[model samples]
Target chain A: MITSGDHMNWKDNLIKIAPYVAGEQPDKRDFIKLNANENPYPPAPGVIKAIEDFRGADLKKYPDANARPLMKAIAEDLGVDADNVFVGNGSDDVLALSFRAFFNSDKPIVFPDITYSFYPVWCEMLGIPYRTLPVGEDFNINAGDYNCENGGVVIANPNAPTGIGRDLSFMREILDANPGSVVISDEAYVDFGGVSALPLLREYDNLIVIRTFSKSRSMAGMRIGFAVGGDTLISALRAAKDSYNSYPLDSVAIAAGCASVADRAYFESTLKKVMATRDRLTAELRAMGFEVPDSSTNFLFAHHKSRKAADIYDFLKSRDIYVRHFRKPERISDHLRITIGTDEETDRLTAALHEYLG
Target chain B: MITSGDHMNWKDNLIKIAPYVAGEQPDKRDFIKLNANENPYPPAPGVIKAIEDFRGADLKKYPDANARPLMKAIAEDLGVDADNVFVGNGSDDVLALSFRAFFNSDKPIVFPDITYSFYPVWCEMLGIPYRTLPVGEDFNINAGDYNCENGGVVIANPNAPTGIGRDLSFMREILDANPGSVVISDEAYVDFGGVSALPLLREYDNLIVIRTFSKSRSMAGMRIGFAVGGDTLISALRAAKDSYNSYPLDSVAIAAGCASVADRAYFESTLKKVMATRDRLTAELRAMGFEVPDSSTNFLFAHHKSRKAADIYDFLKSRDIYVRHFRKPERISDHLRITIGTDEETDRLTAALHEYLG
Candidate 1:
């Protein structure tokens, strides 16, 4: 028989580590959820049709370990060869594998200090040494800062929480300087008007651009994310993934993913709608005395000069409007990262903000 | 510009590792697949209903990262508290997380020499040192052999490729001996007439019994597996999982898993049918001069007295019947591990075997 005392001895690394905390997924669905930067619209009509038409017998057998058909579809959609594509359960899964595949060394990997919170958590969990380079005052990535001695580089394009995107030339500069290390551009929000580093794959073998269906394709519930890179980089990622979990994507995900990739028209129309709503929201937030950054992604990073960000967040919550507000880095404590929702949701959010400010 | 030749360097550990090869999911579905140990019957009717009724709007937002609802359902079904359950994309995912969470130390972890092949692959990928203890001459786990100094222990109940299950008392003996370490009873095949170590969880906080929806519930393609353990162990696994991928189980999987668990009668009926077919197949193979073990899984482990296992495998493949035959572990090189499929699949396999033997 074991006792409570036996629980004290988990691995030393795990014991000292703090896990990543995702944005709140409140139980109540009545809120206008502007948190998590998720797509406000439904997935493509084809995705729904594919799910409805899925065969029950297929669930009796194991899914294709490689998910070749979905990978092929993703590759064609991204204008890459199937060999250059590697998929995972989600972009987080892909990123974790990539970190294992590429970022273990004597030197530390480098990323922006205020980038996606999960990067540092991954580094801590894997025991990979990493140094955080701070983003500029404007919350834009300074590529010059990352061209140093390091194991690798990971930059979220259209950087999360900030919604700022660096130009392709800046990405090229980093790639050229870091010829020996893998530089991953997490393009989770690139579909929302940000320029992708995918074209950089042809120029730099070290460049791996990660994308996801969660944000743009409106399939966050499905968990599909993939990486596009040179064959060698992709091969390494595949090796790491296969070693961990062979069939990461289930049949439903694969079918939904394929349908999502094939329906280019719906993807574009939805993205355009989000971008339009984002512009409108940015204007409204600015009109209300909030300094809204020019967002390339679907979210606006805004700070009210008079009101506390936390107070605004709490006030919005009271009115059932959910937006993200991070506590760390201290500098952005006064900022609220609001995801652009449907026109109605945006209107509701602005009205709530006006009432709170009044 | 990057060239194809730039593919020379990956991490040293990854470069040295060889990925696990899953059973071939042949594109052609005409052949009888008895290779990967998948369930023969379709998923529960409720599972199908869940899939058909999945809303597109739900897919727009991220799934509940912790999968609390499904965990609650699983816990209720398993007669455990929700805190005792830790769910993942599959049992493979659960095993991977458990390995990372518990098995990292100077001392080497241990497992059976001929258990699931992924165990060694995970060790190689994660740099976890593991020593393999050979099973008994009869291909059964000898608990006494495991009562030694080690970092951790992972035993697949009803050990894979050789469908023999160790009794709960024997598991208790191993647990009582290894009080300082976590003993993961991978009960992947335990539902097939094998007694689970779950009842021992009240006495042993160190015992973690893993279960899956793939085989018994006929939801392999949906990829849901979970671990039941003390709160401390479950907390550690959850921490590791959250650190890695916040949302491993997609919405479709959660819904289907809940539906499958709720349909108790369907699960029991399907398992009974497989067990019945397995008994009949074992008798037929024994009549054909094969040594068949008393299988406690949805598969049979048999060896022909005179024929080469590789030759038999090839012969069956030619006849559109697929069965697993591993080349390593020379003691079992002559053995064939065949999954208990539908009655018609069993008949076809026997007919092909008779033709080959005649």
Candidate 2:
């Protein structure tokens, strides 16, 4: 019995895969984790109740692979029909399926170099050739760069790491520039501040707007994500998902996701609270002589430029307050991505930074 | 807004994709659904209670993408190390990932021509060309036929559509013959009657045993599936899953699954009852002059050469007693895949069949 974790032959590229390293979840009591950009608020009370009372034995069977009920709920909330919706395990799953379903094998896909890190990962994993266009000095996407040969397009609204968003005017410009490409608007943070691309789905089958339950709905552990688009695009994603994992979500997930979405009042209130915290935290960080981006998401990307990011990271880690700092893209080396905690946690974070700076 | 779903180029193969259609989930008073093979038993009472009592903010955070906690629970139950295990949304997801990770890109993957309908569907969707190995006159898988050029091997124990299962000696022979290929043993029906291939994992790194909560555990609505193997094979699956959906199960689902697994007494009793019913129903079907397969799963496959499977399916549906009928391979055209219902529901099916035969 020669024990092994890797079996048989594998593709050469699979060997080089540096899979995304999720935040470490230590079992210590003193830790305050701001590593993953997860929502601070719990799911709406209705969602909790639904899970507790969900007595459907049919769940002992496979879930509706089509996720018809969740889609209906999402569509109704977004004021669209079921035909325009597709759902998955998370926004990441939807993005991966979309990449496989729509990206051309011949032409390379295009995305901003500083956008979501997962974009390149998807292209590589799917064997879709792709290129990363550099963001402008203002950290804005250059639509002209993707005017040439293309496969698919991905724009992370309120892009990760930088917290810079691409608004609708620029989004429409890119959609126009790449007439032949599938444009995916990843609105993982849109509800935080940016406008949605869902309304544009009526005009473009190529436009895919991806959203997640992790942020506004405060159900990251529930693992639900959705996409809104024209029928053709939705069909392709549907085909890929069905071919892959028929029941991506179990019965409890769908029940809770539907309940969370239906509680519009809770979602609205949660969103407002997060936005208020984000505004306060951004000002506080700047007051301590740090350069922080005006964030649209629940997190801020900040740097002192004078202070080494690693030193600050070490200082925070010693205090059991964990934030994210990646050693990638040399240009962003000085920055730290901090998820905005509640008012009390933020106050604690600012006080710690004040001591560290002194 | 020049929106189009079709304009974004897809792989030439993606357009030709026709996903497998699961049975209907009608939004009425839940009928005694005998379409998909699911356990009639509800999950452990503790499982329901745990889900109901979940008042944690875990839902607001991301799940452990690696599913470390669930893996530990499964490993502890199986007496295997956590490293030698993997889990996903359902067994179907694990099967799909295995096809790409363990199977070769060059040769045809082998399975029974009359086995689980999803086998060929997966092959077609992944563009992994496959050659169907026809089952014997007894509907038994011939281990000798697998000596040909092989990419990998997959077998649904107590094979779907026809519930007959293969013996351990024959499985050993198949695995020995194809030393280089990955052998996936889907033991979805094992607890019902068939023996598990889990013990074989120590002998072959290529052996992956897929199990589901849908059957014996009665948590199918919770959508949790697991695979047991040597560590290396597990790593490949983890890589594929991480690159796809980080969190396959939500917090409530995680809670439910764990609690269900913990209550061993409940599952043991449920299995005994289901097995007893299976034995009784098989004898009754045989006495009724219907040629029934010796089932090891929760379903029975029966046929009358004179009657078309479609006609029988329609006849049952008209009476609100539904069964699955596939028309692809001509051999099983006269057969119906019927799920084993509770005692009363089985009696109804038997009464309905008696009338149909009369």
Candidate 3:
């Protein structure tokens, strides 16, 4: 019998995973939540109607191993065939599968050190080694700095925490430099006015881009996530998914996701509201004397040397308003990651911050 | 820059993964799907109602990272603290997480040679080695055979394909023998009629039992699965889930799963109907000369050596009825996995088989 001993001793840089820390979810109610960068608005009416329309059959029956309808809708929206797309419980699920498909090399994976904290954790868990590139002094990625011989590059476009994003031109350049490596652009927050890399799918076969309905779509509770790439890349992800969990998305998720995706008008309108709110929120934070990064995503990363983010976070928590602050990675220590909520939610957050600063 | 080079150099035990083949989802028309064992009933009305209640909220919002409500409901049902349970996309997701938490070691993980095919796949993906313990000639696990020290033990109670289960006493004995390792009882089909090993939770902290909404609860379309174990074991899964995908179950899935669990009468009625259908179908198949196993699941595993499982599977498929068949693991090749369906659906399957056989 083959023992895990041989496999255990043959480790692949497993110790380096600094797991991603997300927002708190205490059972207590009445707390204002501005953590984990979730959108504060509810989903579209159509999405709700669809969920209401959801029918349960024998709970013993497995869901469509292939999320047929959900995949079809996504492909139609992306202008691709359903075969070119794969959906899962969350974009994080798809992203994890991507790590398995794209980063199974002796070389390392390159991404902004301060990017999504989940990237490194995926590397460690999948036994895939990774290399982190510190963002430039301005807290932006120096795309050229990812000069590795073997490993590909992954970047959360409009990156997380810092909330800085780059244009497609730089992404193309990054791909040009590492032609052999896979370039994955996780566009989780893309619909918030950032352009999608999906247009470039035809340009690079190694390019795999991931998108989620959580931010722009507001169906986070339904756990639907997907990826768009060359058929080969998508097939590889499909293989991993099939081997891992065939039916990751349930019926309610598929119904809601299809409804959410099809209601493009609602998606666009809600996104416009978020963008407008984000602009106002950023401006308000800046005027309050905090250094707010020009965010491309729906969330803001702000800090004030006058008051540490930790102290501000603590003060807000006392007032039932919650935001995000990280102590690790040594960079972005003063930063508080705050999600842009509704006007009312934003008001509550801004009002609470003002009191804390005072 | 740490590179994925180390992982690139890695060759997973691809050979060990006898890929799990879920039921075929044909696009032409929605036929009677008995391929993968899923509940035939829709979720309770309350489930859809809960989803509808939250439809107006933007689904783009990040889900509650901890899945507090769903976990709370699950804990209440299991009669344990919420901390003892962890919510997942499906039981498979929890099972995959278990591979990393309890079974990631140098020792060999052990399970029946012919059990859930996905078990070994998880081990292979995580680089955990395993020993395949053969079931006795009657096709059941003899717990005494697993005396060696290893990473852990995984058993799909009322094991799949065969759909036969061992009683709680045997499970307890095995848990006692493997005090140093985790013993996972995948009760995906347990709620149908199989006795739950859940009571053993008080007796053994080493035991982690997995459950799903896909069966018995009649919410396969909802894509919800959960795990209950010692708080320490649950914590390991929680840590992995946080680092991997913080919000696996979507809002609809969460709301639906909660409602399904809450609606005891609806759930019980559906299970009763499925159990009744399963019993009737089992007897009918035996009368027709198929060697049906004593099933505690919603499905039956049976076949005739002269009348091949694959041949019957194909015949049923042509007639728009589907069942699952495996090409690997020589032990069960002659067996066809048939999920008990609605009375009419079973009639259709048996009718198709009778026509094909005659």
Model 1 over residues A1-358: C-alpha lDDT tens digits? 3465754454342334454456676777687888888898999999998998888667988888878889999989878899899989999999999898888677889999888888988898888999999888888778889768778889898898899877899899888767767889999999999999988788887789998999999999999999999877888888888889988999999999999999999999999999999998888889999998799998999999899999999999999999988887797888999999999999899999999989
Interface RMSD for candidate 3 relative to the native interface? 6.2
TM-score pick, better of 2 and 3:
2
- Runs of candidate 2 with Cα error greater than 4 angstroms are A1-20, A56-58, B1-15, B26-30
Q: Worst ten-residue run, lDDT, model 2 chain A?
A: A6-15
lDDT of 2 by residue, A153-180 (tens): 8888878878777667777887777667
Instruction: Return the lDDT, model 2, position B13.
Output: 24
Clashes of 3: 60
lDDT of each: 0.87, 0.79, 0.78
| TM-score of chain A, predicted model 1, versus the true chain A, to 2 decimals | 0.95
TM-score of 1: 0.96
Clash tally, candidates in order: 0, 18, 60
Query: TM-scores of the models, in the given order?
Result: 0.96, 0.95, 0.90
Candidate 3 segments whose C-alpha is farther than 4 A from its true place:
A1-22, A25-31, A58-61, A305-307, A347-358, B1-22, B27-31, B58-60, B351-358
TM-score of B-chain for each predicted structure, in order: 0.95, 0.93, 0.92
Ranking by lDDT: 1, 2, 3
What's model 1's lDDT at B63? 83
lDDT per residue as tens, model 2, B267-298 = 88988888788888889878877788788888
